[model samples]
Target: MTVQNILSIPPYHYVHVLDLNSNVQTLVLGPKSYVCKEHERFTCEPKRMISLSPTEYCVIRNPVVTENGVPVVDSDGQVRLRMGECEYRFHQDSFPLYPNEEMSGGVEVLPVVLADSALRLKARCDHVDTDGTERKAGDEWLFEGPGEQTGSSSHINCSSVRCTEISRSRLLQCFIDYLQFETRGIHIFAIKNLSIF
Candidate 1:
């Protein structure tokens, strides 16, 4: 992506050497500030809980670009989760996600993980199952796709006999639908729910 396209996302971080015309850097995101390569060399952070789709949960303006890093580094050298972008000689920073902010938009992922671990982990919505076979309540699904779990592609991870990846639009719609019907409990289908967990 071009530098401008990358900066489209709100809240970023950057370097702040004002005197150095050639060695200056900046970002344009949350709590954004400047870093000086000559004096205060700061790194950039991008948005973490972003509205990937143009759904209803999104509050901030869609900048058309976004970035995030796990175990992110700060200007003071502290290891924290971070997301940001660069502006004209400035850096933007975003509100970090708690260890349990996976359901940022109220829709919980049942089969995949957005991100996890001491290092870094991120999962993107792939698709949904419209023809899901109804099952009894309290069914536990073994997640084996992203996150700390892995399974052979041939082995289906959910109750569904088939696994398929859909477009981003479908993924977003599934998340929206889930938030509407799901009651934050265990269910049998393609996925399950966790308790604020």
Candidate 2:
């Protein structure tokens, strides 16, 4: 059966399968799935951002098809990723996966670079699929925008801000603010070794 036949399955996660020896490429949808909730990774409040650690990685979802200069939604009313000759379709319920395209789309995954790591602090809205699943934002489903530009001056600015201003108390407040809205799931910002000398 073709992809269209099997694509209807709700909440599909695409795993790229590649065999270097044979140069065979295939897309496998599967065992991994996610359902978002308001109080899970984030709250319903606007402008409330999440902070990410350096080790954290995020998956992004592209809301529109941008094969053309202008973006248009796919016929299936789902997300599409065109990487070379192969085009991948995803159910609207899919949380986040990086789009392998050269141009910038309306939606994007986070930590565009180490420089915009601060952008992780920006809060985003949760996605509700047609089936009524609430999709929370995380490294997988983060929507990163054109944040701090990369260059010499930006590097200096980011470094200065990190070194001079960020404090444990401030971080705690940020985490507390985030927690106020979360009703279920573990707190994303749990301070393990926080202490005073």
Candidate 3:
């Protein structure tokens, strides 16, 4: 049957199939592809088949070590993964697997909208400085909003901060009000405001 004809039927849309040779291919059947009872007939006995969501992505990593072409485990009993790359399987996108390549996990990117607020980030792992100084984890950073920030790779904790919106006129009035207070006969003094959004 034609791809359009197959897709028109119930429970058929798209399928990602891994062949016996470990080659991965994606068959686009329709817009809303998923795993269903009818997938086996179209898969032709693949090693594995899964349904991919357009909003989600997978991480492909090359094993750090291998024995006889199989991935080797580290002392911690976990496969050592390095040189990670992302696979964005938007409709009909195929993921070809290389030798000793494995998928780490799938991730779905969620949208966050911050209005009149800021995003606070804390490092979860120790960061090594250029001079060999280890900046311990828990180091905090801020992304001021009403703006857009893109992170390519992040392993941190995130929290939202509601900013205190003060108009320019109100800020100036507060400064003037503070100056009116007794200051040991000092007429002029420096005013410093060190508040993070």
Candidate 4:
């Protein structure tokens, strides 16, 4: 599907499955899933963000497909490697995973690599399959645009990005359905730990 328009979304929480490989998939994180489902980890919510600790935190360790110039390990290809998860750093921000070859349609994921940092931020809207459930794990997750770019592998060293193009519902959905939280509730600790200029 090609994206003609994108909307801005507010953050919420849900349990999302990370399609690791063709046959094997892993449940990454979701606020709703953790509280309701049985997992090996403990979680807590701080402010609008959900933090995940390692008790039940697990990385699927799988291969990935790249979109535009960014490479993400998610079903959509936009991801942030957890802080301690890899040698390369992925921020604790909301991320999307997009399929490959989507820079041609009307809708596209826009990513900006900062001039002073290695950080990358991605923002996209639904263009193809509206059926999130029916879309399956491997289906392409984007629209198309002439000059627009797909999301990034893992957003890096950056702090903020304009999420105005993404819908509030979409943003909430990603958080409720996609984040693996070490802890949920007020992210007082996370916020306190931030680097202040």
**Best prediction by lDDT:** 3
Per-residue C-alpha lDDT of model 2 across residues 54-171, encoded as one tens digit per residue: 3332223333356663444455433355433322222233332322322223332323433323322221335553446464543121222334222110011122212125655555
Q: Which stretches of candidate 4 lie over 4 Å from their true place?
A: 1-22, 26-28, 33-63, 68-87, 90-197
Candidate 1 lDDT, 75-131, residue by residue in tens: 643333322311111122323333212232342222334332111112222322233
> For residue 44, what is the lDDT in candidate 4?
21
Best TM-score among the predictions, by candidate number: 3
Question: How many backbone clashes are present in model 1?
Answer: 30
| Pairs in clash, predicted candidate 2 | 36-134, 49-123, 58-139, 59-139, 59-140
Per-candidate TM-scores read 0.20, 0.18, 0.34, 0.16
lDDT of 3 at 57: 48
Q: For candidate 2, what is the total of clashing residue pairs?
A: 5
Clashing pairs in 3: none
Q: Candidate 2: global Cα-lDDT?
A: 0.31
lDDT of 3 by residue, 155-185 (tens): 3437776756676545322233222222225
What local distance difference test score does each model get?
0.29, 0.31, 0.43, 0.29
